[model samples]
Target: MTSGDTTSGEGLLESLEHMGAAERAEHDAEVSAAVAPGREIAVGQGETLLAVDALTVRFGGLTALDDVTFDVRRGEILGLIGPNGAGKTTCFNIMTGVYRPTSGDIRLEGRSLARMKRYRIIQAGVARTFQNIRLFGAMTALENVVVGTDARHRTSIPGALLRLPRHRREEREAVEKAMALLEFVGIAHRAADPATALPYGDQRRLEIARALATEPKLLCLDEPAAGFSAAEKDALSELILKIRDDGYTVALVEHDMRVVLGVTDRIVVLDFGRKIADGLPDEVRRDPAVVAAYLGGTVEDAEDQEP
Candidate 1:
């Protein structure tokens, strides 16, 4: 039941790669359903999956967030964008339970997450990747992803220690699902590699795959396209779209306008920890305050630059 086993990687991949076309299709469908279970709402529906209601955070005399309110719709990619020190990551930390809000509430499907433990929030079907890569340096990519699957596993520590049948079954299933997620993120070929040995872009992809391994209903990505080249950003855009297409709600906190505009259905602009705009991508891109706060320019100047 532990991640110490390395034989699960290539063996499972070889088995998957050897499947017939029809079998592979079935397996892929199963992976899709497992990764995002019970998420079948239309992308444009006004249903709210997560609500950040008048959320404010402060440290001493400084207010990092000020009554910022927004919602991530049921099946859309909502981009949260802002310049540095504008409280983008601060919001993420609050949503993920790394920090409790000084005031206001964060609700997932109308349930208050204020008092929930970090693990409980994760079990409630919200998972996130860090702004900085946080993969286990010594673990294989598959092993790292398998750790995420632990959140959904029902086996007890006693069962795991006793080598119980249910524990072994869960381990086998976790390995299969982890490999499928790696494949989904286009990194199955590197499943056996140590996470530290991967390239920067691949490491980002690995972190995403690990997050997906949690079977989350809403996936929050913080600066996923950071430090990527143009081509890598383009590829990341496609991957994010593919993820959304497979029926998961996404909250993307990104800096790259092109990546955010290309993949998100809507955008929320934050400035000085206050929400300045919340609308379609085009509208947010054209907002005077967004232009000034983010790009330090006018709307015309922002339009002249490539999105």
Candidate 2:
């Protein structure tokens, strides 16, 4: 079926989607039976979900990321923070296959992603939202989320063309899943609204909902709290934690120190294309190098500021 015609079986799809979520939680529980199930692990404390080792990316004469190495453990929020030109975005580009690294390796669940195509990278269970919001502005919020779910549909082209029952069912399932995801992210009330018409905070939530629709194992959010008011940032923080609680890992590159410190389990600091610190939020906040590179003053000064 055409993308527009995929919402016919919402009831069946909603039920199926709930079943899937329950099943996923069960699977995760079984895997964690030896440990505590459903408890979010601390960064660096579990099996690696995404790893980069000695990764170097260069653009002609400038080295964007030099010898960057770190790992994102499954079921934790890993915050990547840096000053401008610290090569944070470049590192993301390399991991997401937007730019091939000049040297070194990027591994997702132990498989090297060197030189993989962008589409292949998505299929490999990595999805990202841009620093600047990217959305299908002309489409409704539901439609935008559907674009993300489109990749996971099992219907064949010929069957869709002929309007076969199975294809219709799959198409309907995709739309319902998209709606459910939007609801989960607190944007379902705006589902019928055009993306461009929503407020800025809603737009950010929509972007996240879309990315999650891809069913990615690792979700990378670039500057998700940018431009938000303090109250809005607080809500966004809750949304992020809820996502993590739902059983997906997050890798965030954010500028808001409050949001980063409030949401992340561990923080990775980058400066001049090199990793300067990686530790718990409190430890990273106190790290001299991290403070120098970005905080740019004494932790005492930071502590003295009004919250």
Candidate 3:
């Protein structure tokens, strides 16, 4: 056959066997864009507080996260949402140093988080709340918050034994700071109450107050609105924004669509451990793939369930 004839024959066979030119070209473009070295997403109005690139985590043969990537801007609330097993919690785990990634990297303020211990991560201006409330039930709310500020305090056996002037001054400052954090979260009234004595909603607030006591630059909350009523959710949303307005960046993993859409400055949607969308709330809400993956096939499904 002539060269043109042979090329034409091969092209025809390839078209019949796989994606057409348009489909293949579009796929190639996506791959190239993903791997290309350029600005990923502009983090809020300033520098990025946290960035996760090609983050992958595995549990035995089950891949919990496959190249998940996103950014949380400084002084903004970034919502991370997905289905039950979509690795939302796992992402929080990796960020807080609860679990190291099998691959990829996590950075805080452009610094590597690899091999950092949980306490070290906290000391590096990262603090987190659990999906399940993890608080000291036996301790008063004030004491619980005081515990959060312990990392920043300079107390030692010698100081405790001798009651040094410096120790007293440090203790007083810590107590004042803890009280301020509790007041910031609007839970100062319950400061003297045992944590378990507070109502469920208040417990959630207490958890946030305690996390804030760490003086974190970036706060990660796992499902903060999980068991809240509508009013409670609204309050939680306002509190989250208030937290951000107070100059702390927040990364929240939540299931309540209303809370997520209402409070987040931006959002990253994951499905089956892979990112399907990342944009402003309205933009992500309208993304076709995000709708299908998160709402199970239709935008209508997502809307109908929106609170």
In terms of TM-score, the best-performing candidate is: 1
- Location of the lowest summed lDDT over 10 successive residues in candidate 3: 1-10
Candidate 1 per-residue lDDT over residues 255-276, each given as its tens digit:
8888998999999988889999
List, residue by residue over 119-168, the lDDT tens digit for candidate 2: 78888889999988999787788778878876677778788788889876
- Hey, what RMSD does candidate 3 come out at? 23.5
- Going through the candidates in the order shown, the clash numbers are 1, 1, 0
Over the full model, what C-alpha lDDT does candidate 1 score relative to the true structure? 0.86
Candidates 1 and 3 compared: the better one by TM-score is: 1
**Could you tell me every candidate's TM-score relative to the true structure?**
0.91, 0.86, 0.82
Q: After superposition, how far is residue 69 of candidate 2 from its true place, in Å?
A: 0.3
* TM-score comparison, 1 vs 2, better candidate: 1
lDDT of 3 by residue, 166-285 (tens): 765554444555556667788777877889999999899999988877778788999999889989899999999777765678899998888888889899999989998999898888
**What's the lDDT for candidate 2?**
0.81
Q: Is candidate 2 or candidate 3 better by TM-score?
A: 2
Give the candidate order by descending TM-score. Answer: 1, 2, 3
Ten consecutive residues with minimal summed lDDT in candidate 1? 1-10
* Model 3, CA-based lDDT: 0.78
What are the lDDT figures for the candidates, one per model? Answer: 0.86, 0.81, 0.78
| Native-to-model Cα distance after best TM-score fit, residue 199 in candidate 1, in Å | 0.9
